[model samples]
Target chain A: DVKVTQSSRYLVKRTGEKVFLECVQDMDHENMFWYRQDPGLGLRLIYFSYDVKMKEKGDIPEGYSVSREKKERFSLILESASTNQTSMYLCASSFASGSTDTQYFGPGTRLTVL
Target chain B: AQTVTQSQPEMSVQEAETVTLSCTYDTSENNYYLFWYKQPPSRQMILVIRQEAYKQQNATENRFSVNFQKAAKSFSLKISDSQLGDTAMYFCAFMKHYITGTASKLTFGTGTRLQVTL
Candidate 1:
């Protein structure tokens, strides 16, 4: 079975603080994604990487950046945390092949910004 | 641009019963994929079922199945003999890829909250 592990299950940060969310996958998938999930908005993509050091912006990438220094790890960085950035963060990994590749998701990190 | 829609916000079903969740999507491409993902209280998203737009027959996984209507651009999930563990927030997703065979992306729906009761 494919597993995607997130570093934190829950986090709390003050406004204007820097925050990092780490994600790792054991499957060595070529594609990794970061998404923030809100109550009524569902899950919106933040950023995605197809290979190491290659990243692309998704639907809502403002105020967020991502790092993929290695194939197994992907990190989401908030330049400066704000109350609006408080939400559940999810990481997913998948094979960067045809359109049919199903993404495997990690247990999300619920971040709270105060 | 492609967009997915889940109109039902909440649904309830008694244990050992059946329930259906509706999803619709708009896309100009003829080939694409649809998926039903379940997120439990633990916040872990699980792939429940998937259907390819090119396939005419519906897709099924154990007790979970999808009713895919290509003409209407609708894909609905049906859970039979609902179990307590089936209670979760179900999201419908659409996926398309670049011609290079890389850069596959997913567009998600608003999700439907499903509750199972006795």
Candidate 2:
């Protein structure tokens, strides 16, 4: 089974505080993604890394950045958490190709910016 | 860019009954893939079913199935014998066919909140 784990299930941060959401995937997939889920807004892509040290911005990349120093680990950073940034964050990984290339998601991190 | 839309914001079904969730998308690409993903409460989101645009047959897994209509740009998910465990948020997603260099990122809908009642 593919397992994707996040660093935190829930996090609370005050405005202007820097926060990090870590994600680790057991499967050796080449692609990893970050997304935020908001009520009525659905899941919007934040950023994705195709390979270690290579990242691409998604639809909503503002106020967020990502790091992929290692293949198994991907980290999402909030330079300065704002109240509007409060939402559930999801991480996913997938093989670059093949029939089973569909992305597998983590349980998610619910971040609250106070 | 591709976009997905889930018209139903909320849906309720009685136990053992069947329910279908609607999804529509806009894409210019000829070859792509459509997926139905289930996110149960705090649980990890998972793929329920998938349909390839090139294939005419609908995809199914156990009680979960998809009705894919290429001409209409619609892909709907039907859940049979609905159980309490089936209650969750269902998202419709679209992905362009895999290219060697480009990332096959999924574009998701706003999602349908499904509730299974007795």
Candidate 3:
């Protein structure tokens, strides 16, 4: 079985504060992704990393960035946390060999910005 | 760009019954992948089932099965003898097939919330 774990399950931050959400996978997958899930809007990709030090902007990349210094770890960074950034954040990983591979997800982190 | 649509926002069904969730996608790509993901109250998303556009046969996993229509671009999930554990938010996703080593993104629908009642 594949295991994807996040650093925090819930977080609270003040406006303009810096926030970091960490994700780690044990399956040694080459692709990692960060997504923001909102009601009625579903899950929207924020950023993804294909390999170490290689990152790509997804559909909604503004106000967020990501880091993939190692194969097992992927971090999502908020430059300046705002109230609008409060939402459930999910991390996923999958094998890079085929697009048909299933992406395993971690229990999401619900961030609250005050 | 690909878009997945799940018109049903909320659905309810009795335990030990059957329920079907509808999903439709709009994409020009002939070869792609479709998936149904279940997000329970625990907030952990799990893959329920998947269907490849190239395969005419529908995909099934235990009590979970999918109805895939290529030309109609419709993919629906049917759960037989639904249990309380089946209550969750179901999301339909679309991904374009790429060559090996190419990272592909999944376009997800605004999930349908299912509540299994007694």
Candidate 1 chain B least-lDDT 10 residues? B96-105
Colliding residue pairs in candidate 1: none
CA error at residue B50 for candidate 1, angstroms:
0.7
Which candidate do you rate higher for TM-score, 1 or 2? 2
Give the alpha carbon lDDT tens digit for every residue of B1-118 in model 1.
8999999999999999999999999999898889999998886899999888888999999999999999999999999999999999999999974446356888999999999999
How far off is residue B49 in model 1, in Å? 0.5
| DockQ scores of all models, one per candidate | 0.65, 0.75, 0.73
Those runs of model 2 whose alpha carbons end farther than 4 Å from true positions after fitting are: none
Candidate 3 chain B has its poorest 10 consecutive residues by lDDT at B96-105
| Residue-by-residue lDDT tens digits, candidate 2, A5-110 | 9999999999999999999999998999999999999999999999999999999999999999999999999999999999999999999984557999999999
A34 Cα displacement, candidate 2 (Å): 0.3
lDDT for residue B15 in candidate 2, whole number 0-100: 99
For each candidate, the alpha-carbon lDDT, in order, equals 0.93, 0.94, 0.94
Interface RMSD of each: 2.0, 1.2, 1.7
How far off is residue B68 in model 1, in Å?
A: 0.4
Each candidate: chain B TM-score: 0.96, 0.98, 0.96
Tens-place lDDT per residue, model 2, B34-111, is 999999987889988888899998998999998899999999999999999999999999998888875799999999
Lowest-scoring 10 consecutive residues by lDDT in candidate 3 chain A?
A: A94-103
Candidate 3 ranges with C-alpha deviation above 4 Å: none
Q: What level of docking quality does candidate 2 show?
A: medium
